[model samples]
Target: MVGVKANTAAKFRLYPTADQAERLVSWSHTCRAVWNIALAQRVWAYGSAQRKTLQAGEQCSELTLARKEHVWLRDLPAQCAQQVLRQLDAAYENFWNPEHPARSPQYKRKSHQQGVTFPGQAVQIRKVSRRMAHVRLPKLGWVRFRLSRPIEGTVRNATIKRDGLGWHVAFGVHRPEPVDRHVNAGPAAGVDVGIACSVFVSTENEGRQRPDTLTAGEKQRLRGLERRMARQLTFAKKHNGGKYSKRLRRTIAQIAVLKARQARRRADWNHKLTDDLAKSHGIVAVEDLKVSNMLRSAKGTVAQPGTNVKQKAGLNRSIADQGWFEIRRQLGYKTRRYGGELVAVAPHGTSQTCARCGTRDSENRQGCGRLFACVHCGHTEHADRNAAINILDRALSTAGRAGCAASGRGTAQSTRSPHGQGSLAGSRMREPSSNVTAA
Candidate 1:
């Protein structure tokens, strides 16, 4: 535990017995209660004259006193409760830090609290069979879970959580990195993420690779479920929310199942695509997209009502269905793991700029047209394929600072802007920098 470094989490489904399930539920409740109470203490203290902030170590001592008063709290593990306080302390730190994206820590509700984490000493995993294993917990002993795969290293900690599907356990085991060096034998490629297609890849071996999006049947099914759930909720509310409660639950569950399936398919597609890219490409260039910003709700305020809100909403769904950010994230890690480079260039004029003539005119980009016919040069190609080629060329034009930095070259590096702007003033730096739009 002292030397182990966290590499990744290995999650497995947990099939708890009825008695154990009740205990796990109780533990989740206790953790949530502790978090809310601790948050309240710090918040109230903030308004006081002294304005002293609470600390986890101090709270750990207070927890002992509280357990003496409320015997029920003692039933759960001490480390679990302590971890909750530590989590709160970390949250407060984040709130005070200027660089952190932390907001005010709010009280955790039972439905929202994921679960509790057990420290290294408290988590003991033992293999029961080739495909099954048992983990010992604080209150519930020997809960059986699928083996799924071998735990690579010593289990440092375990997080118990429940999702729409079911309960599961995630082990934070630290596996050491291998010392062998990797040499890239594959070619460089550029990827353009879009709504119509999940991603259009421009690689040397294959002129262009475009993966299919969610099937029409799947989209139709999701829409049907959404409508059915909405109708059931309306009926339940009209009936004072008691008589149609069962029917409402059934409808909600169906929607959850469909959403979960959709998520799984996207994740599978993303992983496979990334794996191939990482394995075959030494340099992967992608447009740095702010997905959440792009997907912001189109419903504007009262004064200026949004235009084409419904159309925008549908487009947002398509953008989300592509999982643009997820693909980028996976490529980042996978490229590093495979000793490759991940270059994220600015996404400003990739579509409008022709790959042939480098034309930046709007006429070069016909609206809703898959074909890109450059009026200046008369170069015609698939719009996505054209964009992908531009992205790759943009990434390769600068000798790629990402690769230089990863290979430990920290110095003045020039970057070419995607908009065909002149080179930015070069400066000596310790880390790699890419052409990203300034906020």
Candidate 2:
């Protein structure tokens, strides 16, 4: 919000020809080769000197080291091999002395590795050929992409990544401003996220409804594929060591494809949901749910008070599928994109805390089916909606923004300001805390 800075991220799936695809695979191989070579050198150093860690200068030099064993670097162009080894060194260093003491860097396998980047220089596009790239690797040809989005500012290299369903190239750019900062300030809203209806709002239209984008049809297809996969099984030979048959392997691959497609669908749903909220609302309020704690708690599992173990497992699986982390990530970026504020309210006591008189002790309303009622002030509301409203109130109050709550009885209390100045914009009523009661 202070320093006006802009950046661009563009991703496009490459429709490479068969030859191009094979070339890309070879490029991947080259990257792996360079990394493995560097790794081998580091291992040898550690073994020879019996040292735990080696410094940058102490490590093998690019020229002298590559000449003796890694001759591939000499004939296959210097930049490619140099960048790969540089990345390998960085990876090894990071793992050896990770920022967190508890986290230890594990070995990286070459089979899964896909890319390498040069800070600001790899795959540079010339002025005349600004939109295309010439991949000058072993057998890779010139790969081109339609300039879907114009690239502004310095091209900070490119990364060719293998995705779940396809291959993609991402271009990171330092771009010019698209919209003014002042154009982004708007009304705030509280969001109650759920599986049934992704997000329920309590601002702007007061109670406007937005349906969950995860289609039922997509879910049915996923279930069907899973069932089909479960029905197919293979047993290894008792004497000779042998895995599943080729036909079975193909079946497993098909299941993997289906699962990946479902994941992509879910990701797209969350992105669109977060984008809409950020574009429309200036301030977004959400609870900082301890999802891990929830999963471990009694409410997270056990349908009917400890009955139906199978049902509880199904419930847990569905909860994990909802993609809570993805939602949070999208919201963070979306808020920044719109120049809006996103407040993650503390989720503790939000559900039981009464919005009317701020009383939080037992006697307000017993947790029955799915509703909340305050005994002291006699305020009643839908359980989830009430929690969301309370979260909204706390978020706005913390930021010095204005808000007020309505009572259950027909009468209204006078509006009070945080600094005793005036009521919030269109606030109906508010009251100071009084007698406390939980149920």
Q: Choose the strongest candidate by TM-score.
A: 1
Model 2 pairs whose backbones collide: 361-437, 361-438, 362-438, 362-439, 363-438, 363-439, 364-375, 364-438, 364-439, 365-439
lDDT of each residue in 1-439, candidate 1, tens digit only: 2434345567889999988878888888989999988888888887799998779888889999998888668887888888788778767776776534347799876448358677656767777777888888777788888988877755556788876677888876555566764755577788987766557787532332334444788678779878987887777678775355777777666766666666667677788988989888877789877676888887999998899999999988888777777787677667766767778888989988899988887898779777888999999987888889899888878556456434521221112222111211111111111111111
Task: List the RMSD of every prediction in angstroms.
Answer: 9.4, 14.4
Q: Assess candidate 2 and give its lDDT.
A: 0.54
Using lDDT as the measure, the top candidate is 1
Error of 1 at 298 (Å): 2.5
User: What's the C-alpha lDDT at position 389 in model 2?
Assistant: 77
What is candidate 2's TM-score against the reference?
A: 0.65
Q: After superposition, how far is residue 135 of candidate 2 from its true place, in Å?
A: 7.4
Reference-based lDDT, each prediction: 0.71, 0.54
TM-score of each: 0.80, 0.65
